[model samples]
Target chain A: MRVPEPPREMYEELEHTADWALRVQGRDLPALFVNAALGMMELAGVRTGDEPGEVRRIELQALDKESLLVDWLHELLVALELEQLAFREIELQITGGKKLVGTFQAVPIISMDKPVKAVTYNELLIQESPDGLEATVVFDV
Target chain B: MTQIRKQDFTRLTPYLWEIPTSFQAGMRVPVRLYADERLLKAALGDKSLQQAINASMLPGLVSHVIVMPDVHQGYGFPIGGVAATRLPSGVVSPGAIGYDINCGVRLLSSEVGLEEAKPFLSDLATALYRNCPSGVGVGGNLRLSAKDLDRVCREGSQWALKNGFANEDDIARTEESGRIPGADPSAVSPRAKQRGRPQLGTLGAGNHFVEVDVVDEIFDEQAAAAMGLTVGQLAVQIHCGSRGFGHQICSDYVREFQPAVKRYKIQLPDRELVCAPLDSPEGKRYMAAMACAANYAFANRQIMAHHVRRSFEETLGGRVADWDLTQVYDIAHNMGKIEEHRVEGELVKVCVHRKGATRAFGPGYEGLPEEYRSLGQPVLVPGSMGTASWVLLGTEGSMEQSFGSTCHGAGRVMSRKRAKKTVRGDRLKAELESRGIHIRARSMPGLAEEAPLAYKDVDAVVEVVARAGIAKKVARLRPVAVIKG
Candidate 1:
């Protein structure tokens, strides 16, 4: 599995009174999606304390890139709870037009800072920035 | 949207203000607020007023959109907002109800006095933290199959009753008797059920907690006695909603309604405000799915309350004469309910969407449990952790002016990130401990993020609503211990 490297300052947390919002940017759609996943896992407080590792693959398709990002992050949230998995390495690749196959080097979580309840469509907009693409994702925590 | 200045509002009263429809073109109705000048300034500090303006544009809105004193910035709509859409052809926006469907607060009163339990307060906190499952990535005791989970979606607190996690009184005291009727399990998606199944009875993270409090003051003695709340007596407040179950259901519908908005030729300033006509097939399906989530939340809180009672029994039962914990009332702050409200002195059937607000139905509302019918519906407003929570009663003014809705909590003033940066969780815990409040939290950072300083003063928020006559003060509760996820 090919582990992915994210661009510097790909994502940052935005100030929200009631929930967490992430501002993410990347060179392309795939990078944008991966960076958003990493940013979300970061907000979930995914820790690295020499935790046990598991390699897993996820494949999904959506109506478009925005939905794709929401779907990807949502899948991570469910896995974090149901499977007790946190990402250690992130890998994603576009396939067959709308579909994307991704790999996650996950860990048995020692602990996370907080729980991200749901990734919301509230003000979710994937835009064409000068760099490439950027978006803001809000969460129900 | 134009910037809303306090000057733009015409003061209707000491605690009421309004921005007339002429303030904004295309506004179907005016936007009203229950706030004093100070609280109005706090609301104008954020984008809440602009969001309220957006809500006023919604078609079929009855009268105006009511903003509570605790109003703050939220996604598509302001948090502390209540809007009623006329029946038949009016719209229902899931964004207006929030992601955690039926997210609410429940108050459980006990005969045990805080003075008697003071010695065991530490043990009680530990016991509660251990017994009631909470925090990130935590799972509950019960694990259900796909079929049983569907039943949970359908049955709500009744499912808990059948599983020995709840009592008849527990169901009866809850909103909608712990189930939103017409919950069609088929309306819920498989993925939503899967996320919901394991989280049942578990207090999922972020702004959710089980707090042990003392009824510090009673305003309406008769109402307090009816609700079994006495000054100095201990009460447990469970603040959470339908965990992953509700979130998934809302997420599924919000995504589905994106297309529905386009098909209906709706013009929304924000994509998140996607909605459907009340009579459309999508709307019926969403209502059914939302009902399932609402029911699940009722059951979720009921089971947690049950476990909390067990914990109280284990830690304080032998020492106290009575170990029984009775349900005062269980109310949902985030919900969409079909109710009758008078608009312009004419009664109309409407669907009221309360995002981060409580249903403060006046006395004589048929839906309230028989005991509370005379006292009005009990509104439990949990302040931020380490602050004062409230028990208030609905009023005729609420039914007449605000569609029987009041503020939910001490609305957040600072962002979670800012709270973490400004205050250390451990230091905040120490501060609360110095104030004699025992705390058992999963993460210090998590605890810091919910600092009491992050929210508006609960007393002030309560005063505004009380003075406005939307809600009458019943009792004030001061926390003695807190357990957080």
Candidate 2:
């Protein structure tokens, strides 16, 4: 599958580094969240390999979608750190009320580097859309 | 997202709103938010209001919980939240102080100007990045054993000065004079100790930075003179905290307090706001441990300041005295203290928790150094990289309005992932450089997350604090070079 390139206006590239950002934009909430996660992995350069390991099941319920998204990413990063797995593909099923259940395919972390700190609410957004949802998230990498 | 009903705000004045006790059961007093219309609207989009309301429900709160203009959602309490609870009756909540206790900024002024430092800016930044320990879990040059760590936790900057890590001027200018009384190292958890052992003098990642700034403007000439700040003078600002040590201590206490809150029959609107009575064993233990972390942070900044001074001396080739580098002030944004404040026309001792906020004591406050006694405490608000940072002074109004507190920094307007998603670190660096601001960091992604666009306008935030009369503007320092950990 061809990886979608982020919108040009969204990210400003840095000097002497492999990292990139999307400063994502979408009309719907779910789409924004999905794109934000995609953008983070893109910065981590997690797109190339496809090992397709065991399926990892995760479920989280937060007070709101914003909190839910933060918790979801935090759990995912923690799992990646502790389980030594990179999730290549994720199947997210959101139950309108702050709960999300997902099944993800793990990619072995052969040479993973860099730890992400806590997720911040800085410039985070979850907007309503006719099609679905859109959001923006900032991760302290 | 959960649909939380916005609470009807009762305007106490043009700048204050009260979250009445009737709004939620178990609230000992109302919660007061200090912000203008714009800030309030922006806050409506976040969970900070809910957090402040939750904090009001904590046990033994003396009066209304207060939120500053720079408020943003944070764990347990709003980042700019302040709550002062009547001691013995009120309880202490570790969450109110935040994970990074005493996470703060320290400003150092130099006799050198931009012209003198312009030639060496890049080398100076490089030297700072090389000498200072930064990034996640990065160890510092000086490793301390358990005994040494105890001295750091208990004595704070005093320990640093004794070991030649700081100078006399640094101590005199530092808040609490580099030591917070009542810090009992024994109260610190073993895990906290282990984490702090090798982290001294290190700048942890995420919003932590060391910037070379030029005093672009001085708002109050008298205050600026007292601070030794002049237009075009060079200064260094170090932004960091107690690191893992404070995080672990907060974690340990938050967990400990959860059970204590239940045992004490303390009703809280949010689980994260768990707290125990201030006089209780649980609360005392938490405060003691919190002080230990606060002291640790003070020492951390002092050592880092020493390293900065050394870097400047090495790169600029000037004698230490000739450098004329001296600490202006150091203030914490996260921590709780037992302080005296007037409540309902009477003097009362209350436990004040300022998370992502700074204490802005006005003139005549006993806590300020003698030199600044007539001027008030200095409040440092650092903007995002490549932006202007400000120095404000405490006012008498702050004592009555915010329990002697003010804003901390330009509150986040974007999440890190969103900022990174929107901006590439390299491009951001280039953009800043093109605009004449030098950028240096360990990770480009880190740089992207801290892009200036990710934060609220520091100018606007400072204006609110100034207009609200909690703090008065002192000086505006613009970054010439920024180094992020």
Candidate 3:
């Protein structure tokens, strides 16, 4: 019997002094959003509580897809700081490469190893990839 | 991205290098670097020089883009980079000032001798950790109403004085008298205000710290005496910024400028470098909002200073006869200021954006305090965790060459990911403790990321600036205890 190959990682951390960066990939725009959210939470070492989580929705519009992705991730970060919520599952819808509507099942954050200050647009460009789309995001910390 | 090579630079002097506009297309002026050959090689290992070159393309830039010896790669602008643009037409990029607006260092000297304070070192560290709110997701002791928050936005350290967090001398020693002019709270976003309301007086995570040190050496007795430094005496350094408030403000502006740049027909190599003309409405509003964050940081440090003084008193009041901590200086390294500087033999007003650089005004500047008018401004250079920090003075060379600025701190050479992968926080803490240094931290991974090996040699960085005549060293401080989040 042949062994199945392990799935590829949705995101990988990049090297940056004084900040954090990650290269995120997905099969579609919505997947890209989901992976970015997960990657950010992972980089911050966020751990969640065992209680049943709550579902929250966010709607945002921006000038472009890159901006929309940033806004989405920023919303998640704000929720992590203000509401102590960490996303367990994320579903996103992209409209016209400018609008994003998303719902996430969030659990109470038990602990975080670090904090990301802000999401940046430094050299940020969403490009075509073998999977579907890819982009590099830098977070000030 | 193009790879930078050593052959690409013109060796102007033993400590200075220049990359003329002829090296690249669309560069408005030359990019000057202050580094010895070895430091220059380290800069070539990263993309910081390229970021400086990109910054040179900004409109109405005067002289050249100045890169300090400790320069490192940042998102839009290189850390330890300085740029001045002519007013009326020049642009002010938010990234050039950094996300943590007014992120700075405050040094306080004391009459307490190291011998007298030795027994209370551990207790002092514990007191400081308990008194100062730190780490991620921690709220401060005071909650502000909307009106009181606005007062902090406008009044800066004066708000702390009114609230009994600071004395007049502390304000006098602070940069811009602990408050920048024209801070309009109305211009700040509601989201930023909400974030600022809860985070005041917090030393947020990611390299922000409070360290206690002993004056190990004094390079200049006159200058050191003027700043209240004495060998074998204890001192405290508070390093932090505006916290979530500043981050949200910078994020809001950087996002808003994505559209404003298009409206102004501004062309930038990177989207993060997006900016607006200083005379434009967008630029004016961003400046106003930035001032609010700047003032907020000033007040934050003032309140932290109060707690630090209390911590000292609670631990060593009777043990040491004179345990009072006096203000040496408070200066911001990450900021954008409107000032007058000579360009091409003409005195011109410009906006000097110092991302990871400190304003090092030399002697004879009227803005300095009366005691320091002839002694020049005090420039505090904090090292990475478990290293020697320096006290330096601004020089006339800084006024002439680097727009009244000098290196901020020991710049990072290794990435956080690489550091965390190779170093264990528990082992590092044990090592430091064995060296007689006390450590208090909330996160192991965060502590691992700030290991000393991850940064450049601060002594080497200071030597480059001193040899270049941009700044003069005064004293060296050795860490005895540290508190971090």
Candidate 4:
């Protein structure tokens, strides 16, 4: 199933005492996932090189939308840490809120000011909103 | 969100407060908080108490959930929270133990006087910053193969010792001798191994650092002498953990436990607090994998200690009479240890989960080294950057009250975002440098995020723990040099 790209009111950083939190929204599940990834990358201060990007395909399955979101973000986090990979462009397909098929243009990261250690499931809930869907995530820094 | 009011708590003592099970639904145990009036107000300002109430609902919890004076809001179980569940069928929540498994502090005392080392502080800081890898996506010089990584998973600090990164004395002074048993490398995921491989000696970013301090005050001369801490002398504190390896292991388990909770029919108020029984296959695997990460952290710190020693030697050897730094103690703040604690007058086996809390085993515990056994285990409490750190000793009160645990650090009072907004990293660095403290940091924004104003006062936190009898102050340390990632 496909939906139009969400509005730019994608994600916003929320205040957390000891960690990083992001309040993310999307017109659809795929948009929500993409925006969440972009929010995390921005929060960590990730910057990429000008070199051409490589399109990579990612297929992931989880118990639910929240789990899928965490798994997806964590996949990007690991790539950023281990391989210095960041997404330049993203195309995600969501099915039943349990499986995700994403093809993102991976670019080499030049630098990241801070490291986002792990994506947490703290108070994590993906709910229906008038706009589409909304969820908040906490990242352990 | 459940709102917890200050008036809802029953003041058990001047420094101890309690929220009985009646205060919330599904609570199996009362939540006990160790905080003075002001700190209690601070606790109420956040959702920490509400999280504590949620933690008390975990299955098989024994006694009460202990909240330290430095308690603050975390995801599910509040940071600076401690809870022990009866063994065999007791539940183990990875979130309660935290993501940075075995994230801890190692304190090494030195005989070199602060005055003598003052001139060389800059060089020492530079040496440390260069020797010990810091910053984001940084890898250490020691690149381990898959087989060697397994050895690290199995041997911990012993591996460092074999590789000349640690000494026998260093291992002897460490908690659990720098290696935890029941670590099965097979239990760890390949992704975790991949992350742990090259980051052994690196100090990754976010609230982690290597700081050189001057022992400014000795609260207990007897205990201080035993730990080789003296007024006017220098000390080094290395604060970090298992790095990416531990984070991955924890993330993997926390995700795995999401469904495990459903399988075991354990109900939790928050999904982050998802757990499995100790006897269950899921729980056993998590424990084994967690131990591997714990051991990896032990080796990581040990290797960093070696680099610290080398940096000290290279910078201060020819100038000072002695530049050697001896291990005072190394203690993990985030961990789940299986031990026996006296509960309700009966010695029972339990899994004590300390998330952002330290194990402060009192005197006479068999786990302590012979010399420290009479004085209790030394607890290393590294303060916020630019603030004073503390050296404390465990007491009988900790055994009876907090499951042999105490506060970890001056817990965060302000959000990192707020800190960055309020304090410019360059300006803060300049201020500390003007105060005669040498600073080496990775990024200005990162430094801004860890501004001292972001955390609670360490002295007040120590006072609360000291008054509560969970830990006793031994020495106070003021930073002279800081190396941050």
Q: Please give the ranking of all candidate structures by TM-score, highest first, separated by commas.
A: 4, 3, 1, 2
Between candidates 2 and 4, name the one with more favorable DockQ: 4
| Per-residue lDDT of candidate 3, residues B1-485 (tens digit) | 46678888888989999998988888999999999988998898788999999999888899999999999999989999999999988999999998999999999999999998989999999999999999888879989999999999999999999999999999999999999998899889999998899999989888999999999999999999999999999999999999999999999999989999999988889888889899999999999999999999999999999999999999998888998999999999999999999998999999999999999999998988999999899999999888999999999999999999999999999999999998999999999999999999999999999999999999999999999999999999999999999
Clashing pairs in 4: none
Interface RMSD of each: 1.2, 8.8, 0.7, 0.8
Binned by DockQ into CAPRI classes (incorrect, acceptable, medium, high), candidate 3 is medium
Candidate 4: regions farther than 4 A off: A1-8
Model 3: which residue pairs collide? none
- By DockQ, the candidates rank as 4, 3, 1, 2
Q: Which candidate has the top score in DockQ?
A: 4
lDDT of candidate 4 at residue B56, scale 0 to 100: 97
Q: What is the lDDT of candidate 2?
A: 0.77
TM-score of 3: 0.98
For B1-485, candidate 2 gives per-residue lDDT tens digits of 22334347887777777777787666677878777777777777667777777777776777788888778777557788899888777878887887788999999998887887777888888888888878744778886989999988889999999999888888988998988888888888786787778788899777799998999998899989988898988899999998878876876676566557778887666555778888888888888888898999999999899888888988887632356578899999988988999988999999999998999999997777777899999999999887889999999999988899999998876766578779999998899888767777877877787888877889988988898889999999999888887
Query: Which segments of model 3 are wrong by more than 4 Å?
Result: A1-8
DockQ of each: 0.72, 0.07, 0.77, 0.85
Error at A123, model 3, angstroms: 0.7
- lDDT by residue (tens digit), candidate 4, B1-485: 45788888999989999999998789999999999999998888778888999999999999999999899999889999999999999999999999999999999999999899888989999999999999999999997999999999999999999999988999999999999999999999999999999899999998899999999999998999889998999999999999999999999999999989988999888999999999999999999999999999999999899999999999999999999999998999999999999998999999999999999999998878888999999999999888999999999999998889999999999988888889999999999999998999989999999999999999999999999999999999999999999
* Model 3 / residue B304 / CA error / Å: 0.6
- Candidate 2 has a TM-score of 0.80
